[model samples]
Target: MLPSTYLPSVNRLAPPSDPSLEERYGSLHIRLLYHFEHDFYHHTKSLHPGLKDMLALFMNVGFATPYLMDELLAYSAAHKSILGQQTSQLYLSEATRLQTRALTLYNSASPQISKDTCLPMFLFSSLLSQHVIYNVSSNVHNGLGPILDGLTNSTIIHRGLVAIAKASWPMFSEQVQQQLIRSCQRDYMPIPSSADSRGECEVLLSRLNATDMKPESIAVLRSAVENLQDRFDAICTDSSHAMWAAVQDWLVAIPAGYLELLNQRRPEALVVLSHFAVLLYRVAEQWFVGDLGIRLIRLINSHLGPAWEDWLEWPNRATMEQL
Candidate 1:
């Protein structure tokens, strides 16, 4: 095994206070915020003001709704798991129960989804998306199989976000309104690949056979890979947690046809997607992605084989050479 120092400090991120030994988790909410959310904000500096406000509402609102609270707990537990806490499974179990309660409330509570209700719905959905990532990443059998599943969760969450922002942007504070607008622009989000990796991406992209696919499809796929590369660059500059969130956002924002191609296991599509596996492998030490990245690289190789090995040359080396 490689020395732990070679990896990102994601797992070493500790919460602010000790967890409650209380079986009832009476301090669960406070612990969740102080430990997980605070640490995350400190490291990433990129979490939205809207989310920050929702968390505050979860604490102070007299009517601190069930779904909102449940999502908070689920997010906290999942974050704990990612940080390598020994009690991750225990926290995950509690998170699962709370998520179920949150979903039930969501099903029963919504005809109005208006300004008064939209923020909570948006926050709950966003947190649930993160929770799903933690859950899928932690499972032994999950590996590469959950890539699309995680992407699907992110896509649904993004749709909800767009709808909510359209109706409720007026309701948020001016700062939050600006933040939402910025997110809509997507220009300010961190780039995935670093300057050093640009050459690698160019090399990979150049190998694609344009004759085999339509120009439109090629354009879409090329855009997706470039964005992925940009995200890889961001990961190196920012905390892995922050950039991973951006990546999740990227998955949802990518052209819908990207997923369609992935579903078809098109070689060109997989080749581009394989680059993301290399990015994921960078954080393999974190409980979030675990060995899934390594598995994904292998899966890609198996799918493409020696015939297309040249296309995978950089990514295969990336996965193998990691510490």
Candidate 2:
């Protein structure tokens, strides 16, 4: 298992002359970086055309930090692995090794969140999250145990960013913050809130409301569901590729106690998550998410047994609509 992802800022500044990717990381990474820029990056854009702006902002954070470059190269290799390229195992091994190297480079430094470092750090963490989710989602044949473990790892990665962001929000460049943050908050503007208007979420919310859990736990689950409602209402309707942000929020901004329940695979939390998986069903062909939506809902249905079919009914039908 990989170490908990850490988005550390270097205590020391980069050298007087910023080194280029080929110059610093050498030829093997140079080719991967080439594939990422010329091929993989644009392919993602084509897949999620509406997300062009958000992705442009994401990719603008550069190889200034070697770990960020390492992440890019690793994800590039992972792309080849996912596609079942020649020597797919070699690509997978490279992807795994490079990501580990990225984490080590991050941890080796003191984490000082200067303005200069904020966006790069955010992108670093985000790329890390994508690769984790993509890697796990791609390999779902490994079974639910590892998928759950990967889900835990992905959550830990995003939560680490949330912690870092909370501590360093002021240091982040105000100019570019809205470009990303507003995409995340698009639902915040004058949207309908009553559960009746949120038809997709009506059952999920009602179930949370009827539950016998503690008020704190109840509040946490409700918060996750409600935020999920925001995402479903706004992003899912457009079939936006910005689902990356939804996945990120699902991991990071989820109500604190909700994650504990999810970690325990509480019926309530998993049911809410199953609903979200229906949303994921839209992008199933996207390599990053793979067929996770179908797989996750099926796994949850089986895991929860027959008694909970009432709760899973809508999610199951929704995915069938995709079929």
Candidate 3:
């Protein structure tokens, strides 16, 4: 349990003065800086045994904030002194690698480009990976159904629904496709007890029967259902890596709807979507990496925007002692 007192202050650490560090390190340096400041290193150690490795790999990418780095290094030194030498050496090596690659990639880009191209891909990959980890874990806990219920009411869900509607090809089996149409027709319902029970799918069907669904909405529902089904199928079939891959695909798909909701200035939708993102990220990291789940944790903390710093603060001493 972290203390509540430790708010995530703005990253006050200056970038390395050396222009070479900037050229060589690229966005990876920023990532490392962001993560380290958020105390990912400490959190990774606290995760369940199953999630540690994935967390470590995330950390290895060296995305951290300066404040987080100070805490991480201090925590590591105080509690795991013997591992300090090895950890420091590893951090330095990875940082050096990132810097060199960043410089090379930047130099090759056209002068007209204003931003680092690699940054988007790297960030996307990291976020996608984390989202996958979270989805798998939530599914295992039976949490996704409720989360989806929340999303169904969201404006973003509307956009996603619209996207699905616009697709030219059918994305799901006829039966499933119809079921989704019905589900979105009425007020959303809870998940059924079993395949035979009256589940959300059944509620959807009831809604459709009550009203004529817009052909466009039908198309949108069809697309969303199909996309979801494909992911579900992958999860069911691929025993070795299905979990990771399916979750990644799902996260990648989220921004389409998410951005739409954001554009509409729907705060409730944003809250739900953000929760979905955080939950998915946590579960994904837990399932794939075990104890080292902190990497994604840190990434999420940073990406949640400025407010997360305050959220990451340490608890009072009494509260800490109680834990």
Best candidate, lDDT: 2
User: What is the TM-score (0 to 1) of candidate 1?
Assistant: 0.68
Against the hidden reference, what TM-scores do the models get?
Answer: 0.68, 0.78, 0.30
Candidate 3 per-residue lDDT over residues 170-272, each given as its tens digit: 5444653454344323222332234434121333333334445455444444343344334444333323234434444454454444444434533323333
Candidate 1 regions exceeding 4 Å error are 1-58, 61-63, 82-86, 111-113, 175-197, 214-219, 229-242, 282-295
CA lDDT, candidate 1, residue 188: 41
Better candidate by lDDT, 1 or 3: 1
Expressed as tens digits, the lDDT of each residue in 238-308 for candidate 2 is 44455655666666667767767877878888898888787677666567787898998888888899999
Off by over 4 Å in 2: 1-27, 47-63, 162-190, 211-216, 321-323
What would the per-residue lDDT of candidate 1 be over residues 1-323, giving only the tens digit for each residue? Answer: 21111111211211122333233236765676575557655543453434455445544431366657656776766666556568767776666665555554565565355656666655565566555556556653644546655544445555555555466667776865565455433324445334455565777667653446888888878888777766655544444555455566566667878877877778888888778777667655444566766777787787678998888888888776642
- lDDT values of the candidates? 0.60, 0.69, 0.34
TM-score preference between candidates 2 and 3, better one:
2
After superposing candidate 3, which stretches have Cα over 4 Å from the reference?
1-18, 21-107, 110-226, 237-240, 252-258, 263-323
Candidate 2 Cα RMSD (Å): 6.4
